[model samples]
Target: MEYFTELFFSGLTRGSIYALIALGYTMVYGIIGLINFAHGEIYMIGAFTSFVVATVLSIYGFPLLSIVLLAGLAAAVWSASYGYTVEKIAYRPLRHAPRLSALISAIGMSIFLQNYVLLAQSSEFQPFPELIPDFDFMEPFAHVVGSSDLVILLTTALVMVGLTMLIKFSRIGKAMRATSQDRTMAMLVGIDVNKVISVTFIIGSALAAIGGMLIASHIGQINFFIGFIAGIKAFTAAVLGGIGSIPGAVLGGFVLGLTESFATGYVSSDYEDVFAFTLLVLILIFKPAGLLGREAAEKV
Candidate 1:
């Protein structure tokens, strides 16, 4: 029981990070049907940005919590700028082209960004400051759960709730939804489709930035190449949950996380990625629309 309990928390912690990144993947796809492959690179940049911020703040001996919060803000804002630039340069012009063109552009941009970061920062792995506090409340059950895990879970919950509320109640949220469902019709109804798309990119990038910052802090290390693998897994999560569904993305994240955890715990760590990708393939084969995804209508 204790082993399973530990595994559960571990999976949830990982899933929380994946959920954040997957949300970014799903939002962009939902709004424009384009997979922003460069998004994972954006996440990498965010982690680096936060690291720079925290490092500078640490020299001043600020509170741990203040450093964490400020680091997150800096990461989000900085990465959001990259997101906007990505959309403007890589995706926006290709929007009207064949879908393949947009996909290739994304791939090209992903490569460009990866190399750009590698050159700017060292190719070596960078360590992140451990800002997450280890809570004493879980000391008795430290074998099963820890303060760090609790923080990850709570942070994810707060982000999910806040994002849901924003999408459900805000005027911008409605516009986003309208543009996602039907771009032409949304523009006809007076919504600025381009603005909505751009905002969507910004929001998605910010979410990815947060994920990158939080996960890097938790793991204590990051590198320019981490984004490639993480991006693939997040994209798989998006597909598993139904790419366009926000709730589905979260569900898929947890499901995929649990799958990886159990695989590593009960089986071999070497097979973790294999197991995750296999599960995604099975889900795709069995339910093409995804667990929570709706099938799109085709106008022949």
Candidate 2:
């Protein structure tokens, strides 16, 4: 029971990261049907940005919490800017082209961003500050929450709540929903489709950026390739949660996170990724749409 309990919380923390990144995948897909392969790269950029900020702040003798906060802010800004550029440069021009062309463009953009970062930051891992506290709250029960886990969980919760509010009550939120439902109709209704799309990218990127920052803080270092596997996992979570559903993404992320953690604990660590991908395949074959996903009827 104790082992299960530990695994559950651990999974939840990981799931939170996946959920944040999955939001970007689901949102962009909902609004424009683009995969935004470069989305992962944006996450990598955010982690690096936060790392740099934290390092600079540490040099100036900032408090630990302050350093993490400033790092998050820097990450969010960098992610938002990167997302805007990706949409503007890679996706916007291909809006009228064949869908395949847009997908290819996304791939190309992803490669370009990866190489750009490699050139800029190198392939070596850059260390992050020790902002996370090391105390375990449930030491008595042999249950413990590492500082990194706590930060990841808290950040994920705050971001999720804020996103719910943003989508539920805000003006841009409504516009986004309208655009997602029907782009042409949204344009006819004077919703400024392009602006909504841009905003969607910004929001998605910002969330992913925060996720990246938390991940870096938790892991204590990051590299240009950090986003690759994490992005894949998050995308899988999005698909598992019913691609365009916000809550679905969150649920899927949690599920996937727990599954991975449990696999690592029960099975060999080497088999962890294999188990995850195998589960993804099984879900696709059996559930098709996803755990929370519903099938859309064909329009007559």
Write down the TM-score of every candidate.
Answer: 0.97, 0.95
TM-score of 1: 0.97
Best model per lDDT = 1
lDDT score for residue 203 of model 1: 91
Q: What is the C-alpha lDDT of each candidate?
A: 0.91, 0.88
**Tens-digit per-residue lDDT, 71-148, candidate 2:** 889899988999999999899999989889999998898889888989998889888777676656644543455667
Candidate 1's error at 240, in angstroms? 0.5
Alpha-carbon lDDT of model 2 = 0.88
**True-structure RMSD, every candidate:** 1.1, 1.7
Winning candidate number (TM-score): 1
Report, for all candidates in order, the number of backbone clashes: 0, 0
Among residues 3 or more apart in sequence or in different chains, the pairs in candidate 1 whose N, CA or C atoms overlap within 3 Å are: none
- The digit string of per-residue lDDT tens for model 1 on 1-300 reads 888988988999989888999999999999999988998999989999998999999999999999999999999999999999999999999989999999999999999999999999989988788978777777887778777778888988998998899899999999999998899999998999999998999998999998998888888998899899889888889999999999999999999999999999999999998999899999999999998999988889
Error of 2 at 155 (Å): 1.4
Off by over 4 Å in 2: 135-143
